[model samples]
Target chain A: MDVIRPGSLQDCLRILKTEHTIPIAGGTDLMVNLALNKISPDRIIDITGLQELKEISLSDNFLKIGALVTFSRLAGKEIAQYPCCNALREAAEKMGSPQIRNRATIGGNLVTGSSAGDGSVAILALDAQVELTGLDGIRKVPLSLFYSGYHQTAIHSDELLTAVYIPIRPGTSSFQKVGKRNALAIAVASLAIYSYIRDSHFEQIYIAIGSVAPTPIRAVKTDLFLQGQKITSGVIKEAARIIQDEIAPITDIRGTADYRRKLIANLLADQLQQLSESKN
Target chain B: MLSCKINGEEIHSEIPSDMRLIDFLREEMNLTGVKEGCSEGECGACTVLFNGDPVNSCIMLAIQAEGAEITTIEGIAKDGKLSDLQQAFIDHGAVQCGFCTPGMILAAQALLDKNPHPAEAEIRHAISGNLCRCTGYQAIVDAILAVSQRK
Candidate 1:
C-alpha cells in the first residue's frame, strides 16, 4: 500500500482526479474499514496535512465547519455554548468517549453515512449543506438529499468533502440518543429536533431520527403535520404516532424494530413537551 | 518517514503508509506501554496523548503522526520518578490487572492538566474511553480526586 500526504487541498484534489486513491481525514472510520477489509485502496491520500480544512467559523448566518475538524473541537467550550450549535454540540458530547472524540472528524462520520451516527443525525436536523470539491469544480448539496442509501452517499469517489455549513436559525435545537450504555455503545435510536414556538404554538419543526431507517432522515410527514400547530398533549400524541408509524426501523442486536418505534415515539413526545414548556 | 517528538525527545523513523502508530511504538520503538485492546476505537487500552489530548493510537496511522508530539505511558514519568498521579493510583489501590492503568493515568492527566481540578463527573468522563474491569472505578476516581485535591 502507498500513502501520500498531500500538502494542500489543491494537491488532494489533483491526486483524486488522476488516481484511484481514497482520502483519509481523521481515519476514525476509514481505518476500521481498512482493517475489516471492507475497502482496500492501493493508494491512500492522507489529507491531515491540509491545514486549510480544519476551521470552524460563523459567516453570513451559517456555522461553517471544516471537514477535518474533530469531535473534540465541536464539544469544546465555545461551540458548546454557542446557541446555533446546541444540537451539534450535544451530539458531539454524547457520541463517543474522549479518546475517540479527540480523533474522529465530522466529515468521517457523515461520509461513513451510518444510519445511527449521532453527529450526522443532529446535522440532518440542523438543515445543513456540504461542500464537495473535485478537479471539475465545487458543488454544494443539501444534506437532506445527500444520502442515497444505507452507508451510501452522493459524494463521488473523485470528490472530497471540503466543508459543512449549518444555517444559524432562531429558536432552539436538541439531540438525544438511546442505547444500551453510554460509552462505546451504538444508538438503538436517536432523535434531533429543531423548532420555533410562536405564541404557544409550533412554527417551524424539523425532526430527524437515526437507526430507524436506511439512513438518517427527516420526518417529512410529522414535520408537515406539526407546522403552525398548537403544542398540546393531544398534538404531541398524534405527532409521536405519525413518526413511529412512518419510520422503517430494523431489528438488530441493539434493539428490535418494534422496540425502536416505541422508543422513538416516546422520545419525540418528550422533546415536544419540553419545547412546549420552554421559555424560548 | 515519520519525524516527531516523543516524550520530549526528537525522533525519526521509517514506517509503512498503513502502519498503525501503536504497532510502531511497541514493535519498532520498543515502547510497550501502548497496548492494543480492540484494534477498533471502541476500546481505549491503546490510548496515547497526541499533543496532550487522549487518542487511541490503534486507529491512527504512523503517517498521521508526522511532526506530532506523542505521550505514551512511558512519558508520564519525570526525572525517572513516577508522577504524582501514578503514585496516587497505587496509594488508592486503583490497579488490579493493570491492563488499563496506563491509559487511565494518561486520560486523567490530560483532564487534570487542563482543569487542575476536576469534578467527579469530569474525571469519569475523561477516562470513559479506558475501560477498567479490574477496579470498580470507585478507587480510580478516588485516586484522581486525591491527585486533584493536592492542587
Candidate 2:
C-alpha cells in the first residue's frame, strides 16, 4: 500500500485526486474493511495528522465538528454543553470500546455510511450537515440527504468530508438505543427525539430512528402525530404505531425486522415518557 | 517508512504501509508487551496510548504513528520500577493468565492521567475497551480504583 501524509488540506486534496487514494482517519471502520479485502486501493492518504480537520467549534446556531475528531474527543468537555444530543453522547460513549471510541471518528462514521452506525443516527436526528471539500471547492449538504442507500453516501470519491454541522435545538432533546449488550454492541434499534414543550404540552417534535431502515430516517408521520398533541400515554401509543408503520427494517443477524419494529415502538414510548417527566 | 517517538525513544523505520501499530511495536521494536488478541479491534490486548489517548493498536497503521507519541505496556514502568497502577493490579490479583494485564494497565494509566479521581463507573468505562476472559474484570476495576484513591 502507498501511504502519503500531506501537510495541508490543499495538498491532501491534490494527493486524493491525483493518486486515487482512500483517506484514512482513525481507521476504526476503514482498516477493518480493508483487512477483510472489502476494499482495495492503490494509495491511502493519512489525514489523521491534519490539524484542520480535528476541530469541534460552536457558533450562534451551529456546532461544527471536524472530520478527524474521534468519539473520545466528541464526548469530552468540548461538546458537553449541548444536552440536546445526550443519547448521541451516550451512544458515542458505548460505541465499540473505549479504545475504539478513542480512535474511531465522527467523520469516518458518516463516511462509512453504515445504517447501524451510532453517530449517524443522532446527527440525522439533530439535522446535521456534511461539509465536503474537493477539487471544485467546499460545499455543505444536509446529512438527511447525504445517504443515497445502504453502505452508500453522497460523498464523491474525490471529495473528503471535512466537518459535520448540527443545529442547536431551542428546547430539550433525548436519544435512546437498545443493543445486545451495554458495551461494544451495535444497536438493534435507536431513537432520537427532539421537541419543544410549552404550556405543559409538546408544541413541536422531531423524531429519528436508526438500524430499522435503509438509512437513519426521520419519523415524519410519527412526528406529525405527536406535534400539537399533549404528552400522554395514549398519544405516545398512537405515535408508536405510526413509527412502527413508517420504518421498513430488514431481517439481519443482529435482529429481525419484527423485533426492530417492536423496539422502535417501545423506545419511542420510553423517550416520550422521559421527556414528559423532565423538569425542562 | 514511518518516524515517531515510542516509549520516550525517537525512531524511524522502513515498514509496510499497511502494517499495524501493534505489529510494529511487537515485531520491529521487540516490545512484546503489546499483544494482538483480536485483529478486529474488539479486544484491547493491543491497547496503546497514542498522543495521550488510549486506542486499539491493532486497527491503527504504523504509518499513522508518524510524528506521534506512543506509549505501550513496555513504557508503563519507568526506570525498572513498576508504575503505581501496575503494583495495584498485582496487589488486587487483577492478573490471571496475565495476557490482558499489559493492556489493562495501559488503559487504566490513560484513564488516571486524564482524570486522576475517576469514579467506579468511570473506571469501568476506562477499561471497557480491554477484554479479559480470565478474571471477570472485578479485580481489574478494584485495582484501578485503589490506585486512583491512593493518588
Per-prediction DockQ: 0.87, 0.79
What lDDT tens digits, residue by residue, belong to model 1 across residues A111-146? 999999999999999899999999889999999999
Candidate of highest lDDT: 1
CA-lDDT, candidates in order: 0.89, 0.86
Q: Interface root-mean-square deviation for each candidate?
A: 0.9, 1.1
Give the per-residue Cα lDDT of candidate 1 at A159. Answer: 97
Those runs of model 1 whose alpha carbons end farther than 4 Å from true positions after fitting are: none
Native contacts kept (model 1): 0.90
Fraction of the true interface contacts (Cα pairs closer than 8 Å across chains) found in each model: 0.90, 0.80
Clashes of 1: 0
Over A142-256, each residue of candidate 2 has an lDDT whose tens digit, in order, gives: 9889999888899988899999988877676777788887777888888887787888777777888889877778889888888788877788789888889998899999999
